[model samples]
Target: MTPRLALADMAATVSSEDLSNLQLLLKAPSKDAVRDVCLQSHRAPSRRLAEATAATLGVPVSQAAELVRSLHVLSHHVLFYNLSSPEQILALFPESFHSSLKNLITKILLENSPTWRTEAVSDQISLPQLKDLDWRVDMVTGSDSVSRMSVPTCLVQLQMEDPCPTAGGESVSTVTVELSRESLDTILDGLGRIRDQLSVVAGK
Candidate 1:
């Protein structure tokens, strides 16, 4: 059997070291598939193997996150492991990854190296955000009754105090939201849609 099939068949039963080795040997595209098989086949997936596999691959940040999420090994160290370039790391990873290390010793790392992407350790070393946040107001829409605004990210909730009240005398309009984990592709697609919408609005 090819490395892929062998991994799929034995990924669940394989030891953590062997599983991680198998993942590194297989092609990048096949890694997620093997991960799925292992998840379904095992009651509890191996965090050690999952973290190892994630550190080896160089796909988008969203795909790397899914592996950690599936294995329930969400951590600052595991997600950012073996990556390069602080600029690239900050761009690729989600905001949650940033928030995770915000309170830790990342401030010290920033002071020392200024850019340390690969040496992300939870207890001893923390990755800091040295770059400035560039937040652009993508869209703004409002009505006499209620207001609405959207950014480049998905249709997430943005809370603010409204001055006006609804017909029901409710000052706040509660929007029912069902949240799910978004992939890198999903975010990029959302941004593309926002860009097209902006173009149409501007008569371009």
Candidate 2:
């Protein structure tokens, strides 16, 4: 029951003052909203602005930063379709914004990812506030690092340093993510019918 679509839902709640800002943030070639807030206040990179924004949004400053970051990804089709992960979505939102949806979101990520084959995470996190797990995912890929949310502090991460791709003879490089044995077992009865599971999730 987590916020099904973070951007759509949040966009609706944005106040009139920030409505234009939200438009700019969501517009093509997304701009940094939080940074804009900082510049407008004549305090670039000030922690206070983040804190203030976080307070207003009822989220952590870190999550606020994530919202700005996601805007960039959502604007760019490549990044949005390729790297946007469930962890990133969950991070930019508080627990109240989402119910027990991390598991569902994790599965959705696996279904949509082109990289999970390379990135695998097996870290133990403990967060009571988070309905799912207490973790913070800071993905360190081949080079580009992106996205964040309140989703407790425990992160569900998928890190891939460098995965040699087998796409044709072009020597493509890609970073993929995968849930560990422990995490999968928590939600799945068995991996034998993963396709079937995905079908259910995809509404097929």
Candidate 3:
């Protein structure tokens, strides 16, 4: 419950009004109903769901909607911190919360924790993976005057797999870099040093 944990910090974000609504929403007779609203909030808000929840809690629809939003954000915070235990989840509540209110919050988080965790993991942005590397050497033979100037250049292309690419769209992207001989040699030297370091590590 220390401020070091983000859940504790997020717990401080709840206003007194929202906290009151949350307490009422959790104290509803049917725990399943409360859990359903919390889970739906994770996806998207629905007016029908809010209205129904409002009726169940005998509060205004606005209050019910706000409760759902608070629960949604709270659940996300819980997932972010990967807090699994009821005690850890309960840390989001004020110390003044009675045992029943604390128990309800813990129950809601524990019941939906697995699904929330799975969604969180799946929502992570994947880093692009290197798929292929291509290089070509070209000789630049002259400029406008044709003074017999010759310079070698290397073109390198890096192809990477696009993680979480759009549906039915290209999943690969290429980056090209042109390097003069001097720059190319510097790159080769760096690569050589990396290879040597890797060899040393492998030997060890």
Per-residue alpha-carbon lDDT of candidate 2 for residues 96-178, written as tens digits (9 for 90 to 100): 43243333333444453433222211111222221222234443344332432212222343332223334454332233334
Query: Candidate 3: which pairs clash?
Result: none
Clashes of each: 0, 13, 0
What is the Å distance of residue 165 in model 2 from its true position?
27
Regions of model 3 farther than 4 Å from truth: 1-12, 15-17, 26-29, 44-49, 95-98, 124-127, 141-150, 164-169, 188-204
How far off is residue 140 in model 3, in Å? 3.9
Worst 10 residues of 3 by lDDT: 2-11
lDDT at position 120, candidate 1: 21
**Native RMSD of candidate 3 (Å):** 5.3
User: Against the unseen true structure, what C-alpha lDDT does each candidate score?
Assistant: 0.37, 0.38, 0.74
Clashes of 1: 0
TM-score of 3: 0.68
Better of 2 and 3 by lDDT: 3
